[model samples]
Each structure stands twice: as structure tokens, then as C-alpha cells.
Target chain A: MASKRIGKQTVKIESPVSIAATAAIAGPKEGDGPLRLYFDMIIEDEMWGEKSWEKAESKIVKETFSRLLSKADKTTGEIDYVIAGDLLNQCIAANFGLRDSEIPFFGVFGACSTIAESMQLGTMLIDGGYADNVVALTSSHFCSAEKQFRFPLELGTQRPPTSQWTVTGSGAVLLTNQGSGPYITYLTTGKIVDMGIKDANNMGAAMAPAAVDTIATHFKDTGLPIDYYDLIVTGDLGLVGKTICADLLKRHGFDISDRYNDCGVMIFDCKRQDVHSGGSGCACSATVFAGFIYQEMMKGNLNRVLFVPTGALMSTTSTQQGESIPAIAHAVSVERDLSS
Target chain B: MYNIMTKKEYEKYAEKIAPKSNIVRNTARAFVVGGLICVVGQIITNFLKSKGYDMDDTSNLTALIMILIGIIFTGLNVYDELGRFAGAGSIVPITGFANSIVSPAMEFKSEGFIMGVGAKMFVIAGPVLVYGISASVVIGIIYYLLNF
Candidate 1:
């Protein structure tokens, strides 16, 4: 049964997939932040007793997966596929973390937009009757990301105001073909949009246009009004990008000023935490969605929500080569089942 | 509201929303911190020379002592704070190099001697050593050829 394809990029999932269970673990810095209570585990140690930040990240992912599965009362044998990624090169965290799990793995790389991308793919797999249980996970460690993307922690380099702190956390969500509620109903795949801005420090600027473009496209495709959903969230677009995204959407006559929220901006208290713009990275949206947003949905406080996770697709090599950052975003509509 | 604009319009709006850098403040901070580091080096050299050490020995000893201090500070996790505050001031000095190597080494020490500390010790400093030594060799060959 082929589902209805909305306008160009939107897929209206006829049989929506349900989020069975979600688990999130955060590092010390994120533990100290405002959303600490939302996370399942807040490890005081950034290294999590691991040798390196990379290993620490892997440890976080593995733990989050186990916790999520346990919470769903499922074993590795029951899971169909594990879709995961991180901010490391080649998605090494997912590779090494789930190596011994014996579950079939699908490694995805969408920069920070990995969570939404994974969920969208997971929903498609379930809706398409390919698999039953799929776990979509993403992790990002501040130290590991900083070492790869910018300066080493030892360098103590001054971060600019526009720069965002990569969230040190991992979040996992269990998407299943059969579950009670909080169903994934639609997905809007974003096109790569580059505005020729090459500054890696200001990733929010590089990613905002893509977010706006995708949001506009989602509304156009679904023929849904701005008020169709209770909430509209963007992944990892910090304070600077949030304003720009809203302004751009407003210019197109969709003023979501009151309903819009950003995962990056929501994760940390920018003023107190010294996290200049806000948080970014794969875990920025991952932890926020798995921890805060999903919990909100489960509690029945919110019904329909549009989650658009944005990513600035640029590597250190690409930035060094003076290539402009190409940004992308993926949208998923999650709604609570009225009957359930 | 209905019409999509050209790329030029998008660029203009993006430029308006982007964060601006405080160039003057950053430059002044870098200058003060960098100058202070140099002054400390000079003082250490003068003190070493006053102790009857030769110029060559004093210079070597000064570098060794500075690096030792940097490693100790890095071990204590204080050098990173200085780095955050001083920016280029902290990075331009030999101490920064010492900090770079020691920090990763200490962080990865938990992985054991060989694969962890030994392998990752040069994670940050590896590129600097490679380029620095390679450039020096190239310059040496050029100098030798010209003189010969």
C-alpha cells in the first residue's frame, strides 16, 4: 500500500509509526543545564570513565540504546534495525558502539539533523512494511566534536558569540510498527540550500535558510496552516538562527513566532551557561526530542507537533578548502492518537 | 508573501541577522595577553642568566621550565582557562604546545599506555610537528643548496 505523497518532498504516512520508548543521557555540562531533569541519566563525568571523548561518546550511545530497549521491554533480538550516527568522522560512535549488539545497523550522516533524518527513515521503513522495530539514535560529545571541528580542549581557544557549543549527549528512540500513541504521520525531506556563507563559526547563519525553506515546503505540501500543529521545533539552530528562520518564514506570510522553538536554544541557558548562541550537534535535537519533546507528547500536554532538525553539512577539510556550508533540514509530524 | 525572492534578497537578510565580531576588543585582548607572556619569558631568561648560567643553557632551561609549567597547569586543568581567556596569547607560546600534548595524553591515559595515551598523545600536536619539521627540512635543504 503506497502512502499518499503530498506536494513534492512531503510523505503523508498512512499508517503512522509509533515511538515506543525514548532514553537520553547527557554529559556533565548538559547535566548542569536547564533540561537536566528531562534526561534519563546525567553523567557527571564527561569521559564517562572512558579513555577518550570518542570512546565516551560511544559509551553514551550504547548505554542509551540499552536503556531505551529495556524501557520498551525489548531485547536486541527483537529489534529489526538500529539507525544511528554521531558528529564524529564516518559515524564511528555508532559503528563501534553497536558492533557487538548483533542488530542490523544503518549508519546515517546528516550532521546535526541526524535525529530527524533517522526518524524519517525509520518511519518510512515501518510504514513501508519493511521492518517492525527500529531504533533511531544520535550522539555528540562536546570534546570530541571540538577536537575534530575546531580547537582541542587543551587549546582553550576563545569561542565567538555566534559559535554554538556541541551538546554532549546521546538520545535514542524506539520506533515500532505497533505501539500505543505519539505516531509519526508525515515527513518532509529538505533540499540542500547553500547561501555561500563559509564561516564555520557561524553555523546558525549557514543552516537557517534551509530550515526556513523546509518549513515553508512542509506547509505548502500538506496544505496545512501555520496553526495546524501545536509546536514547531528546529534542531540545533541556536538563538541567531532561530530569529533568522522566523524572519524568513514571516516574510513568506507564515508567522510562527509564538509556536516556534529551537532545540539548541532550549537545551541551555545561554546567558548563564556561557553557551553563546546555544547548543548544536547531532545530540542537540536528539536529546531534546528524546528527552523533553517526547515526554511532553506522552504527557498529552501537546498533540500535534512538527519537528524540523537542521544540519550544516561541512567538514573541517571542506571549511579549510574555503567551501561554503551547505545546509539541510528534515521535518517529521508527530501526533498523539486521539482514540488511544 | 506568496512570491519567492532571488538569492540576492536572501543573502542581504542573512547578513543582517548574522552576529558581528568585536574586532578592536579581541585584538586588544590578544595583544595584552601575548605581550605579557613574552615579558614573563624575558624575566625568566634574565633571572636564569643572573644565576651565572650561559646564554645557551639559560635559553634551553627557560623553554624547559616554561613547558614544565604548562604541563603541570594542563594536568591541573588550569591552562585551558588561561587559553579561554587569552586566546592567541595562550596558543602562540611554547607552553601552548606543551599544553596541547599533555592534555590529550592525560585525558586518554585511562585507555592504558599503548593504544590510548601513546597513540592519542599527538592527536592535536601531530600536525604541528609534521609541518614544522617538514618545513624546517625543506628550508635547510634550500639554504644548503644556495650556500653550496
Candidate 2:
């Protein structure tokens, strides 16, 4: 029998899916960060010999996917689906990178929350017995994201202090039905929440409300205490959004300050790195989890973690048309299967 | 236990949390950089004049030289660094315009000359050219009609 559904927004997977292997690749800037040692490959060149930043991003995705498959000792033929996305328009990086793979691809878009979104779908597919193995991945490049969303690098637009740098990295996780376990057990899908924030520079402010709403709903649905998990990690709230999220959660009678951490904050030393608030991108959370967090879990340092990746959904066209940023967050609970 | 906020209230909170801007610093940088670029043009114009060129001819020669410098810097990948440092200072000049055109062209040169360099060379500066030429034509027609 499948595990019972907890509440309206949460799912409890009956058969927990294991992450067989994972790989993370980042550009030089991310390599210089505090989490540098955790990443598998840190290419010195941002372009990675590609002609354009967009093409470079595609290379990052392809390299990460290939690395994950190799680590797991599985061919692309063994994988049932390649579930991925990127911050690029139409997720061009994933589409172009995986075009030659010939695997069944499901391209998704949840902005920066794509990692968790893809993982949720991948986990569901495996737990439902629809696929034996699936690979979930996402990527984002700073230059490419800047070109698409803001002014070109040649324009030299000054970034606001509230602005977070988009991480130039890709992370891929190979999920299998059976493995030495750090199993995905539950997931909570988030709603699109908007607080009418119009500024594109302040993504953390736009996305925090959605993250708070999702976390609160997740706790209520699972009937779990704040300490149920060792850590509750947010995708890329950075400094600004993390503070706002804490305050909002406190008002809701839950204090998650001690247990809470954000991938954006974890990925970089904001002050020293000149990243201002922190890092923000689809790759931000993906690389952090695949590199640092997963390794920690494997070493028995952490038992359970609730990973919530948040995203601010706003296109340049929408923002130019005076539309407010709407945000979403998706949560996945990964537990170390000690019994197995 | 969640306390829901109205859109207005949330916006107010968001505004308070937004980063403060240092307009004085930004403006100073822009002014210095922009002035320096103009000074370079002026120096070039003066040099051409000293070499016996007329005022109109000197101005055209100065623009061409500046654009050539911009293209060289872009090819060497140095213009983007200058842009990073100067912000709008490096961008509000003819050299900046030249950099914009040459940079994308060089970047896409690998995708083959026709579809890549030829097609995408104006990806960044295409709109500027279109509007600039159209506006100039409109202004010239208006001035002629009024003067006539």
C-alpha cells in the first residue's frame, strides 16, 4: 500500500526512491566560493570554450549529465527520462544540451525552483513504478541569465545590492528505485504567491512569501514539528529573503531560524564574494544540494532534510508590462534510510 | 496561524527591505567616465586639426578613430572590463556603440559567418540603429520644412 497522503498539498511516497549518484559542475566564480571543494568539476573558463554564454551553459548541462551517468555506471539507454530545466527562455540550455542524448525528455520550468520541481516529478515517476531510473537536472549561467533578463555585459549596468548573482553551474542527480539509501520520501508542491512586488532587482522579496506559504503548508499537512528534520533548506532566498521568510514564519507561530538555511547563502560568502544578498538561479540550489548537502547526508552528518527550492516567476516582457512577480516553491523530504 | 497580508501591506514591507541606492556615487562615476570619453574625442579632434584637417573632417576622423579603438578593445575582450568599471560612462559614447556591434559579431563568429556573425551581429545594437536612423530622418525632415 502507498503511504497515506498527509494533507492537501503534501505527498507521502509509499516506496522511497534512492539517489544513485549525483554530479555538479560550476564556473570559475562559483568555484571561488566557500563551497568550492564540494563541487565535482569547476571549469576555470566561464565560456568553457563555447562561442557564446548560452552555448557555454548548454555545455555545462551536458557535462553534468554525462558525469552523473558515468558515476552511476549507467548508460543513457538505462535512464527512462531526462527531467530538467533552466532559467533560459524555454529552457534552451536543457533542450539543446540533451538533444543528442535521445532520452525521453520532459522539459519543465519553475524558474529557480526547477531543481526541486524536477526532483518531485522524478521521484513520483519512480515511486509510482512508471520508471526504474530517472535523471533530474537543472542549470543556469550568470552571463546568459544577465543577457536574457537584464542588460548585456557590454552595457555594464550596475547591479543593485539587493540583486543576487545567478550562479553559472549545473547539477544532475540520478535516481533509481533501489540503492544504498538517501531516499526521497515526501514532497509538497507550492502555490504561485504574489505580493505585488514590481522590482526585478529584488527577487528575494518577491519569492519569500511563496516560500513561507509553502513551508507553513508543508508543516501543517505533514503534522510535523519544526524539528522533524535536521535541516530545512531553502533554494535561493539569499540574505534578504531568508530574513523575510523567518519573520513571516515567526508571525505564524513557528520559529525556524535555528534549523533553517538557504542554498544561496551556503553557496557563497556574500560579503567577501561581492555577491551582495547571495546567489540566485536554478543552479544555485541544485549544485549546493548535489555537491555539499548530499555529501554531508551521505557521511551521516545529517539524517533528514526538507529541501524547498523557491522561484520568482517573471519574464522581462511581464516586468516591462508592469506585472508583479509571482513566486513558487516546491519541497522534497530526503531521509537517510538507515534501516535498509 | 498564518497572518495573511493585503497586496498594499506586502508592497510596503518589500519597499522597506529593498536595498538603498548610492545615487551620488553612481552619478559621480558616470560623469567622470563620460567626461573622459568626450575628452578623448576632443583630443583626437584637436590632433586631426593640427594635422591640417577642417573642423567637419576632423570630427568625422575622430569618430572613426574612436570606433576603431572600440572595435580593437572589444576583440581583445578589454572593452567589457572597461564597461564593468565605468558602467554607463563607457556605454554613452560612440566607442561603446562600436563595442556593442563588434562583441556579438566576434562571439557568434563560430556558428559560421552567414547565420552566426552576419545574422546575430546586430542582436544587441539592432534596435538602437533602427530607432536612431528613423529619428534622425524625422528630425531632418522637420528642420528642412520649418526652415524652408
Root-mean-square deviation of each candidate, in angstroms?
3.5, 2.8
RMSD of 1: 3.5
Task: Give the poorly placed runs of model 2, Cα more than 4 Å off.
Answer: A1-3, A75-77, A100-102, A337-340, B1-3, B106-142
User: Deviation in angstroms for A138 in model 1?
Assistant: 1.3
Q: Evaluated with lDDT, which candidate comes out highest?
A: 2
Q: For candidate 1, lDDT tens digit of each residue in A156-267?
A: 5688888999999899999998897798988999999888778798889889989988999999998988897999999988999999889878988889999999999999
| Cα error of candidate 1 at position B127, Å | 7.6
Query: What pairs collide in candidate 2?
Result: none
lDDT of 2 by residue, A67-111 (tens): 999999999899999999999988999999999998999999999
CAPRI tier of model 1: acceptable
| DockQ (CA atoms), all models | 0.43, 0.38
TM-score of decoy 2:
0.90
Q: Model 1 — TM-score against the truth?
A: 0.89
Interface RMSD of 2: 2.9
* Candidate 1 segments exceeding 4 Å error: A1-3, A338-340, B1-12, B24-28, B54-57, B100-148
Model 2 is docked with a DockQ of 0.38
